[model samples]
Target: MAQLRYQSRRFWGGLVGVALVLGGSGCQPQQTSTETSPSPTASPQPGQTDPEPPVANPELAVYWVAYKDQEQLVLEPTKLPLDNLENATSEEQLVVAFKRLLEGPANTDKTNAIPEKTQLNSLKLQEDGIRIDLSREFTTGGGTKSMQARLGQVVYTASSLNPKEAIWISIDGEPLEVLSGDGLIVSQPMTRKEFDDNFSL
Candidate 1:
């Protein structure tokens, strides 16, 4: 009976040892996987934006008409910092210069041609010349002397772009044949030479 009891205890002890070994082997990490985690890519910093390419500003000349001795109207060259002049087309450059003329004068010695209320209705570059259309207010007031000065202003300002071409002036959309303040009959296309011959100081 003593031997049988000792034999049973030994058999139970061996079974318990085998079960523990099998459980431990099942829990061990596998060596068949050879895959590795991928590395992370670079990202922009928080709240930061990409830098923009550099741009350049170009210099352009805008013509302004003003009285020299309070008697004669003279053409004054105003330098403009045209930011997009380099990349602009020929017509676009002319438009920019014309727009600058409409900005009024920065020089206290210089004066503008069109009335303060006058608006630039349209601007077009034609094969013949540059046609400029202004609001009807452009012909509202001013004496003959003022009208001539204003006319000279438009001629000279536009001439800076073409230098040797003519400029056709229009009021609202119709050709301007008669000027205000004076009943001067203006030709269809006014040339810089005409302004130089009659109005230059």
Candidate 2:
């Protein structure tokens, strides 16, 4: 009887040892993963540059005819076209100004003394003064007052760059000695001061 009891107790102790070993292994904490996911990256953008500057417009004054208080006719100053002529020479600017004079004035209050049919033949810069040639239509019409107004317009516009400079007038390649049916004698190489002194607008 003592041998059987010792054998039974030994068998149960062996089973309990196996159960404790399995339970201890299953109760252990699980290890966390060490690997990580990649982070997102931003896209690159293009660089910016500065803007360009604005271009300038060239300007000059041209003469027109107007009356002061309706008393008498007088020479009026008008602005020329603002063209893109930054690199143009003085001669080129003068020619452009003269052409604008022939086109007449924008204001209705002012009068254009030059005939509408009159045209610019040629213009040249000389050592003595500026030479201007006009079409025959310049002297074809107008009374004494008209003739004087047209002549004043030409003289002032020609010498606009240099008021002291003289101006030689020609009509159809011929020197203008007498102007219109009024037979107004025009002296050659005219100047602004000379015109203002002798000619009445």
Candidate 3:
């Protein structure tokens, strides 16, 4: 009976010790872990444009073309204008570019006759080709080696900037003969070898 009484006393002592530890003033509540918020995404840097290039220029972008008959610069009717042409800064750039082409060299020598004053009435960029209607001046005389090259130079210059398949040359509403003694058309790209093989001078 005395042994049983001692065992009971030890069990009660352990329970009291556990209770005291749990109720201690120094003990604190468990803390919860929180995930930190990710930093905000960054914006694209300048000059790093999207892989797909924009066909028509941006809202504020400027573009220029040549038109001699008209005193001032003008945009090609075929080109899309997000806004009014008058407001575009390219209006001035067109004048400067056209003037430069007029003075530029086509070759030299007996072929050195200056190109006639021609106006670009219309330029249609089609899936298969580009249709260009010129002024009456584009016709007339002036058929020589250098004069023809000058014609090619002008057509090549415009097509290069916009990047199109063929450039069909026309006058009034008809497809005009290329006037070159050799049958070379400006509706598409022309290589130096092709010019040599076809043209005499």
Candidate 4:
């Protein structure tokens, strides 16, 4: 197998973060942190346990869908650590951060004309990759090219943090046959180059 390394950063609260999801129903919100390499540092005080960072609060994020000038995947009752807002380290926390950013303006690219809001409907860790399910609002209000750019933004942004080969994008919990006319179907393993090229990372 060829060994390759790919990196990405998603902006939240004016900072870049690891793996930023573009749209969904209940994902977490965040800013990006500017670090090519992530160093495992101790989370201070309350965030610190003897072993590791505290687990995410239960039901901390709720599912919501938003539409209007800007569509959204909303997550109510968002829960995450307060001090270091960028770079969520765990899978559960990453999920929550995605939801929050989707609802907020993390991935909203007005210059590119992609609706800035997204949410996390469902996320599961399957094998070596993370399965992220998205809502219909993700593909709203745009031409084919516009939507494609947006999809690229979402895919590369999230995959940058997770670095998973297989990405299954679903519409309202069902897999999409083709995203923006690209052969971006579910259950296919994406190489780092494929992901970066397709999503413009």
Top candidate by lDDT: 2
Whole-model alpha-carbon lDDT for candidate 1: 0.76
Give candidate 2 regions above 4 Å deviation: 1-59, 81-83
Residue range 1-201, candidate 1, lDDT tens digits: 999999999999999998999879986787787766644443446896756569543335676677677876777878656575767776677677777777888878887866788878888888998899988888878778768777877776676656777899999999999887457778879898876666534
Instruction: Candidate 4: list runs displaced more than 4 Å.
Output: 1-89, 106-118, 181-187, 198-201
> Could you tell me how far off, in angstroms, the CA of residue 59 lies in candidate 1 after the best superposition?
8.4
Tens-digit lDDT track of model 2 for 1-201: 999999999999999998999888987788899867644433333573444568553336688888988988988877655466557766787789888888888889988878898899999988989899999989977788889988988887777667677999999999999998777899998998888888886
Candidate 2: pairs in clash: none
In Å, residue 112's CA in model 2 sits off its true spot by 0.7
TM-score per candidate, chains pooled: 0.64, 0.68, 0.38, 0.44
Query: Which residues of candidate 1, in runs, are more than 4 Å off?
Result: 1-60, 69-71
* lDDT tens digits, residue span 1-201, model 4: 122222222224324332243333236576597766534663446766556657543322322223334653222222345456445445565566566546544333323333555557787656756567777767677655555455554454445444444555666877666655444443354534564455431
Candidate 4 global TM-score: 0.44
lDDT of each: 0.76, 0.82, 0.48, 0.50
Model 1 TM: 0.64
Candidate 3, residue 159: Cα displacement in angstroms equals 1.9
